[model samples]
Target: MFNNLGNLADMMRNAGKIRETVEKATESLGQLQVEGTAGGGVVTAKANGRLELLAVRIDPKLLADGDAELLEDLVTAAVNQALTKAREAAAQSLSSLAGGFPIPGLSTLLGPGGGGGA
Candidate 1:
């Protein structure tokens, strides 16, 4: 009978490669962009899978005088919206990369598809 040890070794090596690929893909998602808007699109925000803010946009009309409070609120709302989208994007991207298996320490880190423990 043919031994299965060689096949087992190959499978293990392949699994390692898969893990490496998952890590790389996770990194790539952070480099990718996910955008969100708030206050009827008066404010916009963007973030990556790592939940790092990349940019924000405010409508010129929202820059009028005596609108400091409104502006602040809009900014906050926009950022929160962006964060929500960012979380979704991260989760989807990481899930795609993971292919099904839960990532190691994923619950501890703030990466996508992982919990928000981080």
Candidate 2:
């Protein structure tokens, strides 16, 4: 009983550590910026590992015509590219911090298996 109690306590402590690590990691992500471009750089977006879009840039040439469909596509591409960059940066950062230990559900957490994440 005592051993089990000790193990449980250890797990609780580990959980807290992991929480702290994640908090720090996410905060760091905001500090690091990753840029993603689409349509041959006609559209661009900047995001952090937290997938927070900090900025978006659109080429003036593309804006003149104002084709809603093309504009939408470019925006989508830029955001998607930014999201990919954010994920990559997050994975790299987590890997470095976790010594290559898997991030538990990050990959599966965001992919199709996410099952409607929060």
Candidate 3:
């Protein structure tokens, strides 16, 4: 009975450590940024590791062309690219926090590029 209680305590402590590590990693990730471009650099987007869109830029040439649909497509592509980069950065951060050890369910949680090294 005493051994079981000790084991439970140890498990709880490890769980606390994991939670702390995750929180720190998440906070750190938010400070990182990534950029993505589309339409041969006519459109660009920037995002944070938290996957939040920061800013966007469009070439004045594209604006002058005034094709609404084309501009929309370019913007979409840029945003998607930026998001992909953000996910990759996040995965890298989490992997480091895990000490490169494969954390169960972490890969799935991180999505496609959220595994292995950062």
Give the whole-model CA lDDT for all candidates, comma-separated. 0.74, 0.74, 0.83
> Per-residue alpha-carbon lDDT of model 2 for 1-118, expressed as tens digits?
4856775666567987877896787678778788889889999999876777899999999999979899899999899888787777677776677544445666653343221221
Clashes of 2: 0
How does residue 52 of candidate 2 score in lDDT? Answer: 79
Candidates sorted on TM-score, descending: 3, 1, 2
Most accurate candidate by lDDT: 3
Lowest-sum lDDT 10-residue window in model 1: 109-118
Error of 1 at 85 (Å): 1.0
Report lDDT (Cα) of residue 19, candidate 2. Answer: 70
Worst 10 residues of 3 by lDDT: 109-118
Residue 92, candidate 3: C-alpha displacement in angstroms: 1.3
Clashing pairs in 2: none
TM-score of each predicted structure versus truth: 0.74, 0.71, 0.76
| TM-score of model number 3 | 0.76
- Local accuracy of candidate 1 as per-residue lDDT tens digits, 29-71: 6787877888899899998877888999998888865589888
Q: Predict model 1's lDDT versus the native.
A: 0.74
Model 2: how far residue 88 lies from native, Å: 0.7
Worst 10 residues of 2 by lDDT: 109-118
lDDT of 3: 0.83
Q: How well is each residue in 1-118 modelled by candidate 3, as lDDT tens digits?
A: 5866775666567987887888787788779999999999999999998788999999999999989999999999999999899888888778877765566666665567676733
